[model samples]
Target chain A: MQLLIGTQAVELDKEGFLKQLTDWNEEVAIKIAQQEHIQLTAAHWEIIELLRKFYQLYELSPSMRALVKHTEQTLGAEKGRSVYLLQLFPPSPAKLACKIAGLPKPLNCI
Target chain B: MTTNNKSITCKKLLFISRHAPYGTSLAKEALDAILAASAYDQNLSLLFMDDGVFQLLSAQDPSDLEQKNFAAMLPVLALYEIENIYVHFESLQARQITINELILDGVQVIDSKTICSLLTQQDQLLSF
Candidate 1:
């Protein structure tokens, strides 16, 4: 069965997910993999999880401001600080994480 | 291999932006947010990007000028466990900043690619 979490429904099968990700017909999947260092396999599920949690709490998708503040508070100081969180997810960690997690992308994400 | 199923949480938020933390009241506001969030056991992290990194520069004499330098509040990070600090490597390089120039506490430097990867790993992300 295909799982529809946030951005869109993605199949659990590797090839199905790969095909769906490349449906953009652009190099986005490849670029994300190469530039963002996404593992492709693991990244999707992670994003879905993040997005679901964000929505559950806020009762809305995270806007940029919400995403940043939440990420900083949860991941930053809890560990070493924002640096590690940035290293794990930079610029828009919440967005990327949500994407990889398989959740719907935020409406106002940059 | 096991598939992972972790999600980002939505809790009280505190964002520490040292870079002029606010265009007008960025620093002051950021500190307020941090202090307020900390009260709720909320999540909080600080960023030292671009010119903001200077917020934690080692030595300071804000008192001599009568401008109560607030950087002192940074140390409270340890007590509150709000030590998530991030610095863009490119920004630092462009500014000709050396890691040694700042208060070397919980700061971390990240590259563009890694930053993108990190983004994909969060439930939320913000900038100052």
Candidate 2:
């Protein structure tokens, strides 16, 4: 799959995960979120920033469980709960969040 | 192993770590898979035996080796609800290390007998 980010075609995997990490930017994130039918909010951006930080620090994308833990650590417990995250990013929060953050899909996502 | 039993749904998934941490990326890769499995809310257990015991040792500084301290992520396992971490007691004794020397707490020490029993309960096992 491909996303047209300002006239530039950005490649994506078949599952809609980012094809290249460096190709991610705020604009790309917005596009990806849009494709997922999610409107970017401060709350959503909060998770996205946290995911990006995790990738930078560990050089690896966090798994769903790690994402929740990171959320609880950085944000609060209320936002860290899986139910709350599911409300924000329906379906899979970690996968959608990483795609928007320009990181690879969590290997255990399947 | 032949499948004499009928088809069953996957529930318990075990991750076995036997490699020395930091010398290779195997440890970290294994962790990524474990974390991913945990996210799916699967029944996840981790067994650290053999050189894998070295991964739990404290005071690991990989700066000289230009490697990230991947072991630092061990403490975060609890966040993923992976509280069933098991280490081979004999493996630790063989390495001349004790449980008190480990970086984190709550890791269970089990013998090979228990390892065999745990294997029987798992629907899948991933080893590194």
Candidate 3:
């Protein structure tokens, strides 16, 4: 599948994750969030940026537990709880947040 | 009257890695399995021997190969609480790798005799 950002086609996998990491930009993130029915807020942007940084360091998207732990370490406890993450990205926080972040679906999420 | 006991027991599982990190998928596969097992709250230990010791060497950059740097994943082991990591002392010696060269901290270096005892203590052994 592909996402059209003003006539530029960005390739995506079956699950709507970016096939090319470089394809991701703020505009692309907004488009994907629209598809997932999420409005890109400052709160959401904070986690998206964090996930990108995490992938840069670990080279893999984190499971929910790892995400919470890493967030606690970086952002402190108030924003790191699963409840806060769930409020930003619902249903399945790790999977949904990662999809919008243009990262591969988190391994071990199921 | 008979009573039913419903307590679940966590099994002791040991993963023995014996291959180099990049040449094949064995090393990555072992790491994936270790992370998966951590969610089950099992008693997990990882032992690196032979070429597997290479997985822990610092300053690994796989960008030229277009592969994820395997050493980068080692720190996640601690995050998952899979803390019983071990390295074969003789294997490191044979490869001429020093303990300081490894990236992950708090790994125990054990000789063959200790490895034997560790193996015997495991409820299951997973080899890669």
Candidate 4:
């Protein structure tokens, strides 16, 4: 059983994924501000929020490779800098950022 | 020594980073947060593990790399009473750094166990 919001159907999960949303949001935001010298602008927030949504929907943070392709297509050209995202977050954005975001340090961060 | 109330009012920010100062913006950013919190009278501490220990390695030659001279900032931390600087023992051993090779005064060198203990004492922790 799942709930519906707008055109989308949100799944009701037996898994613990729902418990992690708030923590994941705050951690990644704070980390970006502290680690990358990024002030967490509205633009930056979009990526993490999208990542979290995708995580909740799919149960995993996307790979940088996956995220870049997704960001390029969805966010338009100004936001598709895989290199910039990597430079800003380092290694993998989904792994590190998502971990700080509190969704369980995406297995790849280590 | 002037930090926003955010630092002192909060329990602690256990900052962990693995990059050398000036290697990337991380060191400088960490310094800015520390100074901001210090201004607020926040008590802060740091541990340099892995590449981060390189930031404390004495006699930095920033001119050789054409980067800003940031080794100069390590000493001023004490002026702010931010005395809890620790460099991991294995990190130093792996890099062949002696206790004397680091530039900061009164810096502690501890094993992994001690570092783990310190983390447990902190109210909050962060990594970069």
Candidate 5:
């Protein structure tokens, strides 16, 4: 599938993960969020940046448990709970966060 | 990772394992898949039945078989936040296995009624 971001066509796999890692950016993130019917909020961007930074350091997307733990340690305990992330990203925070962050599908997300 | 115009939703995914470990790689592979799925942020439940219940036996020694001890992974599932592990009650009784003999903790022994209700509630079911 292809996502049109500001007239630029970005490719995605059948499963909706980014086909080209370099094709991701804030603009693409917005487009992807829009496709998911989520209007980007400041809170969402905060988690997205955190997820990208995590991927850069660990070379892997955080699992749900890891994401919650990292969020608690970095963002604070109030924000680390799955309930908080779920409220922001809806059902699957780890998978959706990675998708918006322009990272590969998190390992074991299938 | 799944994306679409539709809003994101949590999928209650159930994985059923009915094979014994070491005879083949099916047991380990199933556990691996479930662990991976746990990262996806879905509601995951793992059920062991039939010969699969033997996998939870404690003090498993694979030295004689020269195989990796895949049963060790059972305890680690909780770390992945996969806390909803279930074993068929009848399967255990048939195999002469007791709950105390299982190596892992926090496993729920479920009867067929509960299993059927769970099956009806799941959005997806994978059996291995």
Candidate 6:
């Protein structure tokens, strides 16, 4: 599958994650967020940025438990709770946030 | 009248990684299994012996091979609450690797006797 951003077509996996991580940009993230019914708020961007940094560091996406621990370590206790993340990216935060951040599906998510 | 009830217990799992990081998938597979088992909140520990000690070497760059650098994942183990990482003393001596060459912090270097006791303490052993 592919996502059309203006005139460019960005390839995506069947699960709507970006096929090429390099193809991701702010515009691409906004487009993906729109599809997921998220409005791309500042709070959302914070976690998205965190997930991207996490991928760069570990070369893999994080499971929900890892995500929570990482956020707690990096962003302090206030924004680390699952409830805080769920409020920003509802339903499933880790998977949805990773998708919007252009990372591959988390291996241990299931 | 009497009833029989079973109690839930967390098993002590020990993962023994014996392969080099890049040569086979065993190293990565063991790491993945360790992470997956962390969710269960069980007693988990890791031992790196044989060629597996290479997985903890610093400055590992697998970019050319298009594989994730296994050393990079070691730090995440602490975040998953799988902290008890151990390295075989003889393995490092055999490989001519020093303690500073390892990437992860707080790794307990143990001799064969300690390893023997560690094995005996585990409720289950998962070898890679």
Q: Relative to the true structure, how large is the alpha-carbon lDDT of every model?
A: 0.51, 0.84, 0.91, 0.63, 0.84, 0.91
Q: Give the runs in model 3 whose Cα sits over 4 Å from its true position.
A: B1-9
What is the Cα-based lDDT of residue B113 in candidate 2? 97
Candidate 5 residue lDDT tens string, B1-128? 45553325678899999999999888888887887887567899999999899899987778699665655557657657888999999999998899999977799999999999989888789989
Q: Please give the DockQ score of every candidate, comma-separated.
A: 0.01, 0.38, 0.69, 0.01, 0.13, 0.71
Tens digits of per-residue lDDT, candidate 2, A18-108, equal 8887888999999999999999999899888988888776666777777887898888888888898888888988788888888888776
Task: Report the lDDT of model 4 for residue B22.
Answer: 71
Per residue, candidate 6 scores C-alpha lDDT tens digits across A47-91 of: 999999999998878888899999999999999899999999889
Give the TM-scores of the predictions, in the order they appear. Answer: 0.43, 0.72, 0.92, 0.48, 0.54, 0.92
Residues B61-114, model 3: lDDT tens digits = 998999989888789887778889999999999999999999988899999999
Candidate 2 residue-wise lDDT, B1-128, digit = tens: 44543323336789999998888888888887887677566778999999999999887878798776765678768767898999998999999998888976889999999999999988889999
- Among incorrect, acceptable, medium and high, the docking class of model 4 is incorrect
Candidate with more favorable, higher DockQ: 3 or 6: 6
| Candidate 5 lDDT, A1-110, residue by residue in tens | 99987677999998788999889889999988887778999999999999888765545666778788879878999999999999888778888888989998877655
Per-model chain A TM: 0.44, 0.93, 0.96, 0.58, 0.95, 0.97
Q: Can you tell me which runs of candidate 2 are displaced by over 4 Å? A: A1-11, A57-60, A63-66, B1-14, B22-29, B36-43, B58-69, B98-101, B110-127
Residue A34 of model 1 has an lDDT of 40
Docking class of 3: medium
What's the CA error at residue A88 for candidate 2, in Å? 2.4
Model 4, span A1-110: residue lDDT tens: 33333454433224223233543335435543454455565656677776666555434445455566557766776776777677656666656555444454443223
CA deviation > 4 Å runs, candidate 6: B1-9
lDDT of 6 by residue, B17-122 (tens): 9999988899999998998888777899999999999999998999999999887888989888888999999999999999999998889999999999999887
Question: Pairing residues by index, what is the TM-score of model 3?
Answer: 0.92
Candidate 2, residue B76: the lDDT equals 67
Total residue pair clashes for candidate 1? 41
